[model samples]
Target: MPLYKTITPNSQTTVKIWKITESFDVLMEEVDLKPKSLERVLGMKSELHQRGFLSVRCLLKAFGYDDVDLHYDENGKPYLKDGKHISITHSFNFSAVIISDSKIGIDIEKQRSKISIIANKFIDYEFSYLDENALNYINKLTIIWCIKESLYKLFATPGLSFKQHCLVIPMSDNEQETVAWIDYEAQKSRYNIHFLEFEGFTCAYAIN
Candidate 1:
């Protein structure tokens, strides 16, 4: 079993990510998943999905909880029956989860070259002032994607466009926190977004 590294942003919240080099079978064995969760895990063809579940389960266990007791809401958002707040995300070979005593969201993505091809689809004026340097641009794009993705997960709105609803504030690379706002019908609100880089990957989280 791979040891999970956890970052404590404060007393009420925790962020964790698992580097997915572990064999899928090993990770599956380490988690105490429920019958339905096991069935869903078996059904996932993408390593991303498996790693996400594995990481989420491990995070829950670290806090002395079990994934078996949790379920997803109508929008496919995972929720603990006891009302504990949680969010999960996965990309390529990495998976992450954020849990807090308050509402929370989290996302992770493997830094990739392909993001440039689809930049217009999700970015907008909110990022207009970002540094134009090549390295900085790539980093900002990844961070924006992660930030929007986190907001989308938190809102659980299926058709919300990242360019339209999720906004990332322009900031220097030295900043660890950003703001994300979602104005979809019935879900209009703002969240405190945070970003971090590790091992060539980027992660973002939003807390309400």
Candidate 2:
């Protein structure tokens, strides 16, 4: 059980991270997935994805839930049967979940220079504050990307453009939290953004 870290961001919110190290067979044996979930995992083409999927079930168990308690909406956003807000994310070797009484979203991404290549596609207002010459350029971009992704999951709206709709307020590398806004289809909402970096990966979550 490589439950790497857990954080209670607020009384109503819980975040859990899992560091995947177990074999697929071991993970399969440990978690009792619903038939649909079992089929989904078995259909995954990549072993890494299958492990990440199973590891999320492992995390759910830690939260006192199981595969049957989770389901997805038409938008493919996950939700809890008990009506708590839930968001999930998984990268190459890590997976995370954030559950809160209020609407929330979470994302985990591996920090890499490749993000810089696609920066223009997802960044707009943030480019003004981002210094390309800075030593932590990739890190900063990763945070912004993660923040926008979390906001996307939170909104779960179709045709939401990250570049045009989501705006992450500028913040320094030393800051653990910031604010962001979503302006889409004449509707607007604000959220508090929190982020963490570990082992070359970044995780961000948003709460309204």
Candidate 3:
């Protein structure tokens, strides 16, 4: 089933990661998607995207819920009908879902050198401590990017600039967790962030 790894970050949270290796047809055979979802997948021009979409449904099934129990709001934030907070993310070959009792967000990103090219766009405070000559510089940048992306998904608020609003505390590659803040419009909030790397990809999630 390619359910690569599962983590119970806390008593109230469950994270399920799927490593997509099956053909699209195989995935389609395993999931029963709503018409909208089916159409959305079909409309995608890239098979990688289609497969990633289906894998998310497969992870949902592992959680004992199907596409019927999942939905999204006007802001494009996903939610569960059973009242649990849900966040999702997928990169080229991996996809993950995090369901928690409190608001949460998840993101999976491939560790790429190009992330440094656009680092300035989403990185500001963290840049103060990032050493470009460090062996894990790219790794650190990818983690920060994943963290901010997760924060965006959690906040689901428009006009929240990643560089200007989100701040991740300094940490090394050996650290699996850290703290981050979202300071926007005088409503300041702190979140506990955790992340891990596997097979050249980084997966991070933020919990409110």
Candidate 4:
């Protein structure tokens, strides 16, 4: 049980992160997966993805739920059977989940310089505040990417463009939280964005 960290962001919300170091067989032995999840895991070609999937079940167990308590919508957004809002993310050796009484979303991403290559596709308004020459440029870009991804999971709306519709308010590296807005199809909504970095990975969650 490599439960890396846990945070109670609010009275109603819980976030759990897992550091994946177990073998696929070890994780499989620790968790009892629902049939669909078992099938999904079996279908994954990459062992890393298989481990990531199993690690999520591990996180669920830590959160007092299990694979049976989770499901996905038509948009592929995760939901909790108990009526609590849920969002999930996994990258490389890390996986996380955020569950709240209110609608919420979460994302974890590995900090990588490759994000710079695709920055234009996902960033628009944020470019004004970002300094490409800064030493923390990759870190900043990872945060923005995670922010947009979390927002996307929360919105769960098809055809939502990260570059055009989601706008992350500027914030310094020292800031723990900020705000973001989604303007799409004449509908507008706001979210409180919270982020943290650990082991060279960035985790961001959005609360509506």
Q: What residue pairs clash in candidate 1, if any at all?
A: none
Candidate 3, run of 10 with poorest lDDT: 169-178
TM-score of each: 0.89, 0.99, 0.99, 0.98
Clashes of each: 0, 0, 0, 0
Off by over 4 Å in 3: none
Q: What would the per-residue lDDT of candidate 3 be over residues 1-208, giving only the tens digit for each residue? A: 9999999989999999999999999999999999999999999999999999999999999999999899999988999999999999999989999999999999999999999899999999898999999989999999999999999999999999999999999866678999999999989999999999999999999999
What is the C-alpha local distance difference test score of candidate 3? 0.95
> Model 4 over residues 1-208: C-alpha lDDT tens digits?
9999999989999999999999999999999998888999999999999999999999999989989999988878889899999999999999999989998989999998999999999999999999999999999999999999999999988999999999999977788899999999999999999999999999999999
- List the lowest-lDDT window of 10 residues for candidate 2: 167-176
Candidate 2 vs candidate 4: the TM-score winner is 2
Candidate 2 runs further than 4 Å off: none
lDDT of 2 by residue, 114-208 (tens): 99999999999998999999999999999999999999999999999999999999887688999999999889899999999999999999999
Better of 1 and 2 by lDDT: 2
RMSD of each: 2.1, 0.7, 0.7, 0.8
What lDDT would each prediction earn against the true structure?
0.80, 0.95, 0.95, 0.94
Least accurate stretch of 10 residues (summed lDDT) in model 4?
169-178
Candidate 1 residue lDDT tens string, 154-197: 77768898998777777666889967788776767989988899
